[model samples]
Target: MIGSRVKYRHLHTFVEVARLKSVVKAADSLNISQPAVTKTIRELEELLGVALFERDGRGIRITRPGDVFLRHAAASLTALRQGVDSVSQELLDNVPPVRIGALPTVSTRIMPRAMTLFLEERTASRIKIVTGENAVLLEQLRVGELDLVVGRLAAPEKMAGFSFEHLYSEQVLFTVRAGHPLLGGGSVFAGLAAYPVLMPTRGSIIRPVVEQFLIANGVAALPTQVETVSDAFGRAFVRQSDAIWIISSGVVAGDIAAGMLASLPIDTSETKGPVGLTLRTDAPPSLPLSILIQTIRQAAGEVLPV
Candidate 1:
């Protein structure tokens, strides 16, 4: 009977070559000799009893069998890594906690619930949560300080090395205090003009949608009295004054439930924003981060409106 003889390093080398589709390039990337890369590939193919590549005069291509083999090999590697990471992560005496950046709105509402669930599931795992605007969050993501960012991304045209996954759409609500004059009902825009507006600072994804809708309908601009990124401030301002605040329904769901704020009878039918998760492209995420994101998607699916 043949004994178990698979080597972990060989599997890793095979994955790198398969991913790059060129032995020389893979070797250079791994800082090894090309022949060493070729030798490992051959040894791996022999162990599996399958031809993994087809070489022609032009170049080499992964064979149909090779493509199938790669799928299994990648899965195996991913499983092995996840297992190893779970163990080694605990022993990482000096490695900082997995740092995650989240938008303030998300951090305030969904993330607290998600984090509580994550901690319950992973007692040994450590995480650092940072809150910021998208511009700051994306920069931290690119510099490797952050593993994942939860928010609506800014400027897809300029974001070449990042990928975004839509978690859910947040409904935009224009809200005010319960007894505010506009409380019962009125023309949405004209009513807005009577009250000072609490607006998200410019360039926020929320701002453009609100501004454009008001302008397109020829709704006169309300007095822009407060501009801030703090949802707490916005909600507090609404409770104390006649200022109208445009915000995500999910963020203020609890407040609305408590009767702290009242949703205006305005047509928000045209306003929807994607609350998304952003990750670095062409890279595999850390296992803890990956599981956390998966949990977020599941949680978002359950809570976010369709």
Candidate 2:
């Protein structure tokens, strides 16, 4: 039997506090006083008859029960927001835009073509794409901030509440400016360490693979290294210097085709990873989301190799 005392405010407050692990931070985020936030949490705990958090001098930690409840609370909030959006769209006779989260590789290479083809076929459709690291995007999808995330499959632990559909695989590449001094070098092992190396940041799905590749090739570290996942910065940096960039091939496919950049002779097929769509398991696809997925499938078929 459920109690009538629980309210949305309680769930919302609980989620904020759980996310930040601090009542003060949660209160600031909610734009409410600390006492109000604390009161709401207490009320929620009383209604449920379970303690959600364990407080300490440093901060609070979610109890085991709280961890489980947090999932349900977050899901409930997501469902409520989805319902509100659906009602608003129906009342306005407008389709709510599909919100997509993407990683840099997909956003730069695949999405432009996909978006163009989708809009051309469905003239009234609207899409909003946001890009970030794999973990951030997955969390946004879990909380219903995004309809789906299109990117490389994350590790199993990072994919708890989502389902992934594989679209294609992409290989990482070692690339440099056109006519870079190391271009025709017989063995890149010696020359690679001599130039600045640009590679993905630690959290990116491709980072470990790149590190492993370097280790296998007996290169302990680059003389100079810069870590990033920005396609724009990578392109400009490589074009003007002898720096070698370790990145997914799709990120610079256009530049390679245009003769502005060149990939080294190294074969990175071993570092290939799956690029795919991730959706919340609890949320079934809405009509707009389905349409976008279908369009993306078509676009991938045309642009990506099987």
Candidate 3:
């Protein structure tokens, strides 16, 4: 029986081979020789007293034992990497700051209120907020630069390393300056076609859905007065022109309340969508991060107002 003298490098090498399914490929990835990779796999199998890989005429295949071992290997690697990151953060006096990335809409609205509540409770911790489009934010979350994100979940399916917690739904609303011809007495959709519309940039998640809805309803080729992604610009453009601006209700609540903009009377039943929180699927969130997520969830519920 091999005693408690096993090293992590041997297990890591085995995992690399199992993942790549070829000694040459794994060796190249690890910057080691194919023979060295083969030896490590053999050594790992011997230590475990099980065949990790079955090599046939076609190629190598992972056995049942190999699958089980690979699961543990991957988990162990993740834990080791996390430990290293924790230690590095400590050495740098980083204090395990919770980095949050959010969509600009949320960044300006619910995020600030939630963060205020979070900071009140966690006075000792550090918090960082980054704002961008959903795609950019998700990419940051995947790369570990963000502990969590509060934004629309992107995709055909959720990415492997992330989990989403649905916070609330944002209803799309079209607004125009007060007393504008298309205001239609504070209706959401009324008079939408009387004036050219200003929309978010074409690549925004809501753009396609909004366009499709308009086209399906026989409102195709609605004149687009302009397109801009900047929230400030959107609000300013609406304030200065009769151009309509579509925005998430949660994002423009303050402007609506202040009487700077009025929602047109159009039925937005077709434009509602999920707005939620995303975090790494496999990692246990840090204590501070957990608290922040809850606070954001609560704030989102309140700010969206059904």
Candidate 4:
């Protein structure tokens, strides 16, 4: 009722000029002209029947009434600004996170770098990463629980409803802590058969590959001492003891590079296979997922061939 003629233009111009202490700056910030800012403030004072500012040498001074009005006016604008931001943030939060399943290898090696790039590519978007055996991840993909899967291709029968896009080729490798009993002076096969061994969890894509490699090398019976897809457990267990860890190269590439682990000299070319992206054949990737897929590819490129 008191400000029936007052407008957003009047309040905004006055508040900005007062805050900046310069009409020239307020006009520049608002992308208007100096005279326009002065004119608008004058209009606001006329409508309110009060002098909002007094000329103070080259600058300006706020009147007591202007000070009171400014406190309320600035607060109102701040509330409006926050309301706009909250609405935008709510919309972003409402968007379902892009759910993904990653094989242990990809989760450890590829995802860390890919996540950094993905965040850069789409700062407002979000994602969820699930890591486990190949069979488990594929099952999650078949359901609606996952939008994508990254790592080696699944078994032929398991490929019925999923499509795979080849990313790179990697192979199983034998590794142990930097200083282990098996590091010198023994036949590799004998050491593998004799020492406690860690292997890929059963039903993982790499599990079969590793089994075949062992069989070819005269390690006919798989080690039952430990079978897991957990990088943390494998690294910890192997480091504190003399257990040999047979895992995909990507999973321990960093460890080997850092000298925390060592790869044995063995031939696993027969176990080499394609690693790739898997998705439901029936479901097209959402735009955000597609961008993330690209980011993963960029990250994957950094993985050195084993």
Would you list the C-alpha lDDT of every candidate in the order shown? 0.79, 0.88, 0.79, 0.86
Candidate 1 or 2, higher lDDT? 2
lDDT of 2 by residue, 1-306 (tens): 454677999999999999999999999999999999989998888888899999777888999999999999999999999999999778656766789999988888778888877777654657889998787888888888999999999899888888999999999999999998878778887788789999888977888888998899898888789988788898999999999999999888989999999999887789998999999988999877887788788778889885
Clash count for candidate 1 is: 0
Error of 3 at 103 (Å): 1.9
lDDT of 3 by residue, 1-306 (tens): 453655787878888888888888899999989888888888888888999999867679899999998898888889999999999778657576789888777887888889888988945678889876777777788888888888876675646778878877777788878998765354334356668787756767777777877776667576555776678888887899888887777667788899999887777878888888888887789888888888897887777653
Model 4, span 1-306: residue lDDT tens: 666787878888988888988888999999999999889988888888899999899998899999999998898888988999999999999999999889888888889989999998755778999988888888888988999999788789989988989888888888998877777757888777677889777777787777777777788884556987788999999889888888888889889999999988787778888999999989999998999999898888876442
Give per-residue CA lDDT, model 1, range 1-306, as digits (tens).
111676877778888887887888889988999999889888878887888888866667888888897798789989988999987866875655778898877886778778766877764667899986677788889988898889875576747799988887776788888888887666667767777887777756677877887788787566665777788788888899888887767667888899988888877877777788888896678777777887777667776654
Q: Of the candidates shown, which would achieve the greatest TM-score relative to the real structure?
A: 4
Would you estimate the TM-scores of all the predictions?
0.66, 0.68, 0.64, 0.83
Off by over 4 Å in 2: 1-96, 121-125
Q: Once superposed on the true structure, which residue ranges of model 1 sit more than 4 Å away at CA?
A: 1-93
Using lDDT as the measure, name the better of candidate 2 and candidate 4: 2
- Backbone clash total for model 4 is 0
lDDT for 209 in candidate 1 is 76
Error of 1 at 199 (Å): 0.2
Candidate 3, pairs of clashing residues:
187-264, 187-265, 188-264, 188-265, 188-266, 189-265, 189-266, 190-265, 190-266
